[model samples]
Target: METSAQGITPPAAVYEIAGRRFEVGARGFADAVAEAHAAHQRPRCMCLVVGVEMYVARLGGGYIVKRMPGTGSHHAPDCPSYEPPAEFSGLGQVLGSAIIEDPAAGETTLKLDFPLTKMPGRSTIPPTGSEGDSVSSTGTRLSLRGLLHYLWDQAELTRWHPGFAGKRTWATVRRHLLHAAEHKIARGEALLARLYVPEPFSIEERDAINSRRLAQWQSAVPSPGKPQQLMLLICEVKEIVPARYGCKAIVKHIPDQAFAIDERLYRRLGRRFEAELALWGASDDVHMVMIATFGVCSAGLPAIHELSLMPVTAQWLPIKNSFEHQLVGQLVADRRSFIKGIRYHLQGGRGLATAVLTDSGDAVMPMFIGLAEEGKLPKAEAVANAVGMGAAAAWIWRPGVGPMPPFPPMQRARSLIRCA
Candidate 1:
């Protein structure tokens, strides 16, 4: 059985609610949560001496604890809600500008550069090779790819630990993605309402799943003289094959369903994500994750409008190149806790941490991979600047220079699992 580090149970999560200390899973915890929600009282997570504040969110009929806005990094590294600082990744660029959080309302408003609706009789513009490479020129709007990256980050799919191996299934991923979409608004519509993440396939429940899917998709179906309402789809790509007229994307878990893609969009997709496609094709363990805006045609066919692809390891950690693949492999083998960095809207040449070592005591260590441009090594100043804000120190690995360097020393292994 999977155990935390060396099998010791970490301290149970404790919170100070309404001036009283309560442990999660303890008796009366539910009552405390309900009271806090009804009284609008924010619970403080007692992970550290000062404690980090959290908010109660209603999920279904019950409530869940969520980290407050901009407070993820303040929690202890071993805390279940710990998140690496935004400066270590492209999230720093868009946190307050493109993404705005209202702590009171518990909602996030996103300014997207892409459209959620497509007009009938109008041709969709094919994406250029550099469309999602960097933040929009205004630096205040998220690109289609940026939005996908944000969702992935918010879902905490970027985090990894040894105990999670073989447990991160489609069901787990879908649950987290849906939870992340809650209370998020894009273009004045609730993101959760517009997002569809396929449920894990179950032969016993296939018909029920299909029925729910069709019912949810009706909102996006085209009607006479009406603009096509588009919905967001996040799924694993099974294959892209030739259909009778145009190409189609066969998504995993949905065996008999496929999303149609036009010739122009298909060609552009090939050009825009050639590296990602090649990397995915090279490894059987790699998962090709696709995020797209899709709408149902008059004939009930789902057609893709704008989309982006990201390659992740079997553990679902995002990786861009062979170097990242190697780095992530070593981290997993070593059984360390870390957050994988994602390039939301940053260009390929821009410096970003590969991962942040959270198990290290006190301060987090940011790992950097130096990508040589044209035949020249990256400047030391540039790498330092990337590692400057919020990081304790830097772990540099220049693949072109030599083999991977040793990772920074980690604190003694301790269980992060806690029981109330």
Candidate 2:
């Protein structure tokens, strides 16, 4: 009680995050203030630590006290030891390991922010010739500042223990970023043409990113044979920046079969895409595509690559008539069906992060999502609804022939059985 700030209410002093809260007591107030201040000072370096036992719980008119070692002790020169209650579970161990087990422990609990932001739903890619002769025909360049801003834009990292304000720990930021980059990289060749901006993402970070990306691409052993019923479409969206002339995008296409080999092929296949619009014509927008498989080809080799022949569309499954009438229930439960599919594919542990260049001079960001992996097409649409995403352009690339983009998927939803 000695450390408690006089007149400060318990409700006002405590804050919650990710299902946990920071509880400061009269005796623990001073230490909490010092810890929070120190962590805030080096926002980038701050790693969160929680003390499970310091909390008190009430149940059915009963009171329970949770206290661990070093509750009232001074900062020790040695690490403190405490056992978590059974109900406290896994997070207890995660937080405990992250705690600073120092010989001089100034605080009993430490809490850091989410550290980095989540990937933005949108991003921009620079187009060729936009630099107005500043860049060579064969040159490939990336913007360092733009990449930093993208990393900063992630909304998820706002709650991080210390905000990114003045905290310039590139090493910690990069470490956290690489973890996220792993998800994109694991998608394989379908994503190989897209560029990824991992934090602490300096030129130095390229090697690590490339190595991980390649490793992930090589690991994806495509599903044996073709999928029955609905088809699979892998899309990578890139923000476009127009060059001196205008904006142009290469919507390269990849077959489901190519996913078995290194997805890097998708990147190589970029040359096959084509555009008739004058360069720099569309510089004010971001360009992306949804490449999917269509009808069989003459060679019967899955056509290898093709574009624009057919438009993209979605079909829903049969559901009980009673459930169909419940619009709110469908909206509430079916949301995020698509994003969940992308997440499932991402978690499957294989795929590439494609790096695409825009003909537009403006900047672009790429997002990769899968349509077939999230159970079925209907669920994927649900996910798209949850995230406010719509139909995307299609990419199909081949030698001599450039990328041919198909029309965006129809926005309206259709049912498996005709609506009675």
Winning candidate number (lDDT)? 1
TM-score of each: 0.90, 0.20
lDDT of 1: 0.80
Score candidate 1 by TM-score against the native.
0.90
What shift in Å separates residue 319 of candidate 2 from its native position after superposition? Answer: 37
- Give the backbone clash total of model 1: 0
Residues 326-380 of candidate 2 have per-residue lDDT tens digits of 2212221322111000110111122211111111011111122223343322233
Pick out the ten consecutive residues of candidate 1 with the lowest summed lDDT: 1-10
lDDT of 1 at 320: 90
Tens digits of per-residue lDDT for model 1, 1-420: 224454222346898899888888888899999999999999999877677789988776688888998778777766777776676687888889999988777789998887888998775654475644312434478877788888988889998866687899989998989988888999998999999999999899999999999999999998888888999999999998778999999999999789999888888778777888888889898999988889997677899988878889988899998789889989988787789999787766776789987676555677888765542333445443543323355777888778898876667333332222
User: What are the RMSDs of all candidates, in order?
Assistant: 3.8, 23.4
Q: Residue 272 deviation, candidate 1, in Å?
A: 0.5
For model 1, the stretches where C-alpha displacement exceeds 4 angstroms are 1-11, 131-138, 372-391, 412-420
